[model samples]
Target: MHSLNRLARIAAVLYLLIAVIGPFSIIYVPSTLVVAGDAAATTSNLAASTGLFQAGLVGYLIIFLAEIVLTVILFDLFKAVDHTLSMTAMAARLAMTIIHGLNLLSLFVVSLLASGAAYLSVFDPAQLDALVLLLFNAHDLGYTIGIVFLSLHVMVLGYLVYQSGFLPQVLGILLVLAGLGYVIDSAGLLFFDSYLTTPFYVAIPIAIAEVAFPLWLLIKGVKEEALPKAAPQPA
Candidate 1:
């Protein structure tokens, strides 16, 4: 039981780390710097605040590492509920993390292009700016693609949590709803041109589900007696 609580706390802490870092790096910096649909303005903002852009990249790196760790820990914490389902969820989450890691390369290239390096004399300044905006847009799309896989992880995880009899069943339901929201959002982005123009407030309610999960882990931990006994191994 002690081990379970400790593991849950570690996973929760790692999630909180991403929560803090992700907003600053992914949303705050870009929103503050990049003026949407104005390539020149976006480029100017990035060029002016090069240090801030670099810091965002660093935050993403931490997110990548922390997400990998948290996913593995979650798999262990819930595996007893259903080994196959837990492994599936873990694999999906790992895939999402890997995709996000590759997406970071796009940010790196954009940063380099906008860094005002003398070697970039071959390209026009306006061209560089446009390219940077293009890459940033692509990064956003790639992140949404990753969220599709993450949704699968969340859906599977919800079932495991529901069956485990440890965490609240409502938490599981909320997780499933969150996963559904991701699926809808990702699919809408991929399929509907209008989705690009639409506001993303739908994710706000879904986020409550995510917030509750970590808080429960930190506060309630788990019901130790509700955990299932391990199956005996064949000799």
Candidate 2:
């Protein structure tokens, strides 16, 4: 029980770290570097801020590595509740992690095209610029696919947490809502052309759930008394 409490705190710290690093790479960098529909401008921005682009990729790599560790820990933390469902949650998160790792290659391609390497000199400037936009578009699509798996993971995780006596059930409900939000946003991103330009109000639940969960874990840890008692051995 003490070990579980310690593990919960560790998970909370890691989760909070990912939350901090994620926005810089996923939101701020793109908002700064990408100019929708203007391939040349976007390319130029990447070229001018090569350091920032590289840093963002590095941030993503950190996030990817951290998530791998966090996923394993979370699986261990929750598996006692319902092993099958916990395994499903872990597998779903692993799938999302794999997709995200592969998706980073697209960003690397954009970086290479923008670097003006001798080999890339063969391609005309216009072609390279267009490639940058295309690569970013591909990355965006990959991200949407990854989010689908993440939503599944969260939904299953919510169920497990809700069932587990040690954790608060309200946290589970919020997580379920957050999972729904991700699913809806991913679908909108896939089907709606205007989705990107519109407000992302649906994401509020996700932010709330994520923040609340980690804070609870950090502050309260798990309720040791609520843990299931072990059965006595037969004589």
Candidate 3:
């Protein structure tokens, strides 16, 4: 296989792995653990499933590390379209990646709380429960902050692909809309109480763009004949 094709396929595989691993750990597992109004049950559930909680944390760490690799590969893939914009997009993704890496520490703390660590003996049971829930809340909101930068990365990536003359323009447009959808959802989720009360379906569009983009990269890659060439400047 050609170098570009190989890179695309490798990145695609990583993207797929992340998609599979990320939701189970970051969303589904936590959603199951953190009961809405029942702090006692939440604490009990986490304490009982110490292994599950630790697995989820490890899963998140894997996703964060994989994301850094994917970002670098994508930067190389798209830089030919516009060097400055490509770098900007990569930088935005790197920032978000680092933030999420730190955000996962919140889960790490929860594991310690759930484990009945000796050092935690200073805090009463009720306090520990409250602290765990608080950390969970903080982790969720910190994800929104990371989304702000990830949204920027997606928008610039969309623009770069659209200008590249290799991929379909519609994909680029959809990618941009995906980023916008995330911004709207994040803004509302953070700033407005109503958003929390409702389902965050605004992000559904992201699945569309994200899945399609990677599939295209893996299956179709760039049309070699259609790849853009640098234009000569007037003498």
Best by TM-score: 2
How does residue 37 of candidate 1 score in lDDT? 87
Query: What C-alpha lDDT, on a 0 to 100 scale, does residue 42 get in candidate 3?
Result: 88
Native-to-model Cα distance after best TM-score fit, residue 134 in candidate 1, in Å? 0.9
How well is each residue in 120-200 modelled by candidate 3, as lDDT tens digits? 999999899899888888999898899899999999999988888878998899899888987887788789977774244
lDDT of 1 by residue, 127-232 (tens): 8888999999899889989999999999898888888888999989889988888888889998887886324565864788889999999988998878897544
- The pairs that clash in candidate 3 are none
How many pairs collide in each candidate, listed in order?
0, 0, 0
Q: For model 1, where is the 10-residue window of minimal lDDT?
A: 196-205
Q: Would you estimate the TM-scores of all the predictions?
A: 0.93, 0.94, 0.92
**Model 3: worst 10 consecutive residues (lDDT sum):** 226-235
lDDT, residue 186, candidate 3: 77
For 82-160, candidate 2 gives per-residue lDDT tens digits of: 7777779999999999999999999998877876789998899899999999999899899889999999999998887
Alpha-carbon lDDT, every model: 0.88, 0.88, 0.84
| Model 2 clash number | 0
Clashing pairs in 2: none
> Is 2 or 3 the stronger prediction by TM-score?
2
Model 2: what TM-score? Answer: 0.94
Give the C-alpha miss distance for residue 65 in model 1, angstroms. Answer: 0.8
